[model samples]
Target: MAALTLALDAMGGDNGPSIVIEALARALEQFPQHHFIVVGDDAELAELLAAKKLSNHPRVTVKHASQTVEMTDKPGYSLRAKPDSSMRVALDLVANDEAAACVSAGNTGALMTKAYFALKTLPGVLRPALMSAIPQASGKSAFVLDLGANPVCDSDTLFQFGVMGAVAAREVLGIERPRIALLNMGEEDIKGNDVVKSTAQLFQQSQLLNYIGFIEGDDLFADKADVIVCDGFVGNIALKSCEGLADLLLSNIRSNINAHWLTRWFVKLFYHRLQRSWDWLKPDHYNGASLIGLRGVVIKSHGDANTDAFFSAIQQAVEETQQDLPARIRDRVESVLLEQD
Candidate 1:
């Protein structure tokens, strides 16, 4: 395959362009074949690039944008007011085909709004969904959709989430014929509100989906379902809860380990093993969440992500780009629509 060039919204994250430049260095070291277009204030980004010795790299170039979309900026305002922002410019690279994908650690709402306008959704997709690989206890990843994109979805939209989530799980998580389920209050057929129940009926009627049935929120990370479909409201709450829980557990574990000399020694001795085991639950390990169903690839990095977390997001963009995820979703969507027709 040919080289993949990713556009970076260098000023989007909390740490600003420095971290992006640092993460780009790490990415280049690991993926020399992948190139980058760093978008931000030319003078500041150039200084950081020079400090990192990336000033003259053949694989990296900087694009100057006069503005940045702030973390607290309203999505609508950013879309309407910030035409020359770094985030907008980076997204333009993808839409213009100058870059294969774009990565941003900006305002989630703003990024989504800008991306929706710049890239649009695939044919037959009512709206794009946010999908991420939620780590499971079974050493597998559960692909969950609408993590925080569309707050309210109809039955048809939910069904489409299932299809798109399944395709993404298969492509990114390597889950063959991924078993799918809708997130609900209970697993019983009679549970959940009308929209979910109607969606379940649609899934059952479809010959294209591998829909299994309804699954509770607990089933999200239990390996009960490879792909969990829910409206953004529920999925977002679940996602935030999971992340907060993981942090709490890790914090408690670290505190206890440091509370005693004996436990500290044991931790040191088994550091690598424990580290490997706990890495699965770390937020940084799964930092990138794709804006799935878009016409082009867009990976959202956490607004406050560190260098390691941002690097992981870059890796995600590379993997999804290699998989040609947008095209795969488009094809599956067309297939389902044809079947329904």
Candidate 2:
């Protein structure tokens, strides 16, 4: 049997080679069948592997990439000036079929730009959208698309996002006939701007999607909608705001616990319970965000991701590759477009 090869950009992210090496080690132990090609300086990667006592792993290999695309570099400039950068090299591996998937914790904008230009989007997909799952109250996750792809989107683009997001929810969340909702300021038909109103009409008229009504920002965590569709501008704001709120809430809870002797004693009494709750709320649980509608599977991790976060992203890429998520999405999106015509 052929081994599943995953190309990783070792020089990307804030933690650099150390996090990549640690992630590689954890992934190797967890999924022995998946091989990795670390694209970066061969000597540095080798040293990191040796430090982790993972240099002798049979499934691991190193590919030398001399250039590094800095986070501050423009996407177009980086792609043109540094063809041999780790990010470019990793995508090239996928483009040439040398690897099944590409995973990176690099600049989010650069990754999306590189993936779209290098690997290309699937037929009928106007632009690729970034999709991530946000945890809800019912132990279920809601899919939000265009998280940071296109800041401005047309109704047609939003309609396409709805179709793609629905297919993703079905494949990843095992939800059949996933309920779709348009993200708006109000639930009323006349509440939003021209875009939202037009989108609502489009969804209402379509038979292909299970169009639930409009959903406000508060509906995100209420489990009122399963699949939330919005333009990248709105989606990105919502995503970042949610992250900030989570951080603030966690900090406040910790501060309160440590403020009083009685509360600190109470926390000690239920330390395991408190710890479990905190663990459940950690961002690492949802580390991978797919650049959906592309021709291949590309997962983008947080720029400041650690070893565990990188490993989680790799695991997501493995699952997506094994499931042929891009192909599945292509089929669904094309079918929807055909029905409309």
Please name the candidate that would achieve the greatest lDDT relative to the true structure: 1
Those runs of model 2 whose alpha carbons end farther than 4 Å from true positions after fitting are 267-286
Task: Supply the TM-score for candidate 1.
Answer: 0.94
For residues 1-341, write the lDDT of model 2, one tens digit per residue.
34699999999997787898998989989887879999999999989999988787799989999998888988888878989999999999999999989999988888988999889988998889998888789988888888988999999899889988898888888889999999999988889889988988888878888999899998887887778999999999987887777778777888988999998989867655766665445543347788988878898887888887888899889888877888888898888888878
TM-score of each candidate?
0.94, 0.94
Candidate 2: residue 17 Cα off by (Å)? 1.6
- Give the per-residue lDDT digits (tens) of candidate 1, residues 119-204: 89888999998888878878778888888999999999999999998988889889889999999999899998999999999999
| Alpha-carbon RMSD to native, per candidate | 1.8, 2.0
The residue pairs that clash in candidate 1, if any, are none
Question: What C-alpha lDDT, on a 0 to 100 scale, does residue 336 get in candidate 1?
Answer: 93
